[model samples]
Target chain A: MTMPSVSDSGLATDAAEGSVVLERVTRAFQGRRVLNEISLHIAAGEFVALLGMSGSGKSTLLRALAGLDEEVEGEGLIRVPTARSVLFQDSRLLPWESVLDNITLGLDGPDPAQAGRQALASVGLAGRESAWPGQLSGGEQQRVALARSLVRRPQLLLADEPFGALDALTRLKMHALLRALVGRLRPTVILVTHDVDEALALASRVLVLGNGRIADDFRLDLDHPRHSDDPRLVGYRQRLLITLGVTESA
Target chain B: MSAEGSTLGGRITSSTPRTAQASSRPGGTRLVPRRLTPLGRLLGPLVLLALWELAAQTGLLSPKLLAAPSTALITGYDMLANGTLLPHWLASAWRAWWGLGIGVAAAVLLALASGLTRIGEASIDSLVQIKRAIPTLALIPLAILWLGIGETMKIALIAGSVFVPVYINTHAAIKGIDIRHVELARTLGLGKAVFIRRIVLPGALPGFFTGLRLSVTSCWASLVVLEQINTTQGIGYLMNRARDYGQTEIIVVGLVIYMVLGLASDAAVRAIERSTLRYRKVIGS
Candidate 1:
């Protein structure tokens, strides 16, 4: 089968070589350019992490990928236009909805309730179909978000540090959960994160961004659900540290 | 603070003993435990009553001139017994209910209309905010001139006064919906109705209920003012008539009844809101 192409909103796709090819995408807010000139290409089913310091254009890149913010002036080619979903860093659960309803916010299809339940089950929240997002812990809300994106089974997934705010242990577990989901679902995911280990743990391809450009694209050949400190990944982590220009912060 | 805490703890721990003692009394008590929050609310009222009764006993306040808690309670009961109080209270409640209901319904409809479209929102927001700022009490003169001194005019005035709150709250509620949620709905192809029903209304509900409670309070307050017109009944009419008869106790009694009604209506709406949005606390969303 040909490699899938993901949409701008992180839906799965069948676009072969350059599913997302940004030549020189730039975004400026009130004459201050947030993204100066970002050119990158994301392949199909690629778990690519955009890692950078705060305000280093990683989220700006992800936003451009998600099509959430089109305020930037740029040249970009994004395949698979629809069937996409974005998991915000905030979890953004509908306050009034049950976990299942939050996963499927509004179903515009044949049977949304059933689909929503299935989505809930996909993220290991099977028994919490009737549970409200408020009742759930912070971890559980993020899991609902994971389920939402999983439900779409899109060509791409845009996650802006989806587990950035989680506790150390929860974030570790969520990393595993996300890796498992991406492997099984195979949606081309673009995660904007600041954690180098997280990038190594969750993503197959880690793109370190700085000064509004892809500074380095590190490919980790390790399989899904890898440990945080895998031996082969250790060297890659060191390389990422160098790429991000962090002086012994690791 | 320590004493208060200890007293609270004592109440919690001695509940069984108290209930058992009550059961053994000459008139056996049917004891039902109440939650602390509600019990806590009653403490202030009870303290005020105790102070009033003490003042009356010391003759610092004349029971005839300024009825104490006990005297007022008796007077209130007397009015209740002679069938004068119930009708007046009930009539005021009825008019206030209609005014609040009609006002809130209109507000919700207008909010939905305005919130869904920029043109509707823009056209109304400027004028509505301006009109809202103009005290509804000031409009009583104009309302009377236009609608005449009748029950119709009273209800209309009350409704008009309350509408601004409900409208503003509803509109704000609609505005508070997360833009991401709206985008999610659009991506899913949910039409206007489904989007409004599932996302917009629920998102706006908390604010809407807050506005609604405020509106009901205003409506009831306005009902008192509105009924100052050619009405033979209602709490306002009761107070006005008492003033004419030089019955200071009855006038005080009527005003107290209005206050109680306002408190009760607000409490009821709060209870409704708690049940409706219980899931918010549940999911931590």
Candidate 2:
């Protein structure tokens, strides 16, 4: 089935850049199909959250979009901007490099150091430029990872459970930080997560992946700074949880 | 009734205090200090030396077999004053430095080749493993046949022994680098040179230093064995000559020199390792 075009979706204007389109993307491992004939489209400046159970292929779809699935057997067309960055669950910072260096790593053009400093400042890590990755706490490391991702001014930002390893309080703080950053950067973001509350908290559109296909796709029309206890969010959360085959106890 | 109540209250309060003190004392004692001051570190060695001196003075220890610490020290000083120690020490140091340098260079090149490429691993790794199984001393016979008993053979033996630890550790470290970082590099569009410079080299450093410590010790060890092979001007040669004259003090001096050299080189490597790997969060900072 064909998906709606960006114009009809009314999510973004610059459909030419920072947009992702996939058609009949099929990924398999050991004769088992993880993603089968899955088609998806994301517009520029859209915050899309992909939710799935274990082995539901949410990460696979994200990897394919990021062009990191070359070693995996897949047959499909994936169109993504060349200027894209991926944030994994772990910070993935080079431990030997300082925070500023990690941010500016592979950055081009004149005075990349200034840009790196600004990026660090933006993530509330202004004076931590010389700090090693091992010296920073987990939450701090994730913030540095966020800065590194946004430093390049990537057109598409693909995150695979970036805050999964953080504590609950840290996760809440990161959720807010990510929201503010994504708001300002306006990059098309695809956040693959298992937490329904996180998806509802950050994403404008949420998609549930199950049985190697998109099982549910819907939009949350809530305003910014969404509360988990909001009745509308509660309704969406319950439906999403049920779609994920998880029943909430009364 | 008032006396009975007062005695009961005093007994209860006394038991509570004792229990609190017991609990607090264990907590205080549980925190054993792990760090030692420099003087504290020297205490054991100093005590051992004192005991050795006492044994020698009491005549319980034979000077014929092992000279007293004082005698060894005087002998060492005499050798230093008469200029007999400098040339021999220099010769051994020179041999060790050349051998270590060559071995480290070769190990780095070989590790990069084997660790970075499939074909290099297929061709080089197995050969290194095979060489590792055969001790470098075992090849001294063959080396003597090939290069003859000279500086060349001595250095060759040292280099051959030093190469194994460095190559094995470096190659393993390169292979053990987090694959996620490699993926990050690709996503960041890093070229081959940049990836090697930023990721591969730094990632391999800790392992390389570990191997280097082993290599340094091996350099001294093989030198001792190599110097005995018809050498005229190394510590080993001096010790061999002393063996003929039965001058045990000079032999003790030779042993002391080797011990100091080995310790100093290892300490040097450790300093460099600490500076380079300061990023790591290890015990005792």
Give DockQ per model, in order.
0.38, 0.70
Candidate 1 chain A minimal-lDDT segment of 10 residues: A1-10
Q: How would you encode candidate 2's per-residue C-alpha lDDT over B118-175 as one tens digit per residue?
A: 9999999999999999989999889999999888988888888899999999999999
**Top candidate (lDDT):** 2
Best by TM-score: 2
Model 1 steric clash total: 24
Off by over 4 Å in 2: A1-15, A229-231, B1-17, B22-44
Q: What ranges in model 1 sit over 4 Å off?
A: A1-18, A73-77, A224-232, B1-44, B50-75, B179-192, B282-285
What interface Cα RMSD is found for model 2?
Answer: 0.7
The CAPRI class of candidate 1 is: acceptable
- Which digits, one per residue and each the tens of the lDDT, describe model 1 over residues A1-250? 1211223323333455325666556665656666666666777778888888888977777766666554444444544435566777878777787787777665556887888888787778899988877778899899988887778767777888889889999998888788777778777788888998888877788887778667888688887657667778878887888877876855
At residue B24, give the lDDT of candidate 1. Answer: 47
Candidate 2 clashes between residue pairs 3 or more apart in a chain or in different chains: none
**Candidate 2, A83-109: lDDT as tens digits:** 889999999999889999999999997
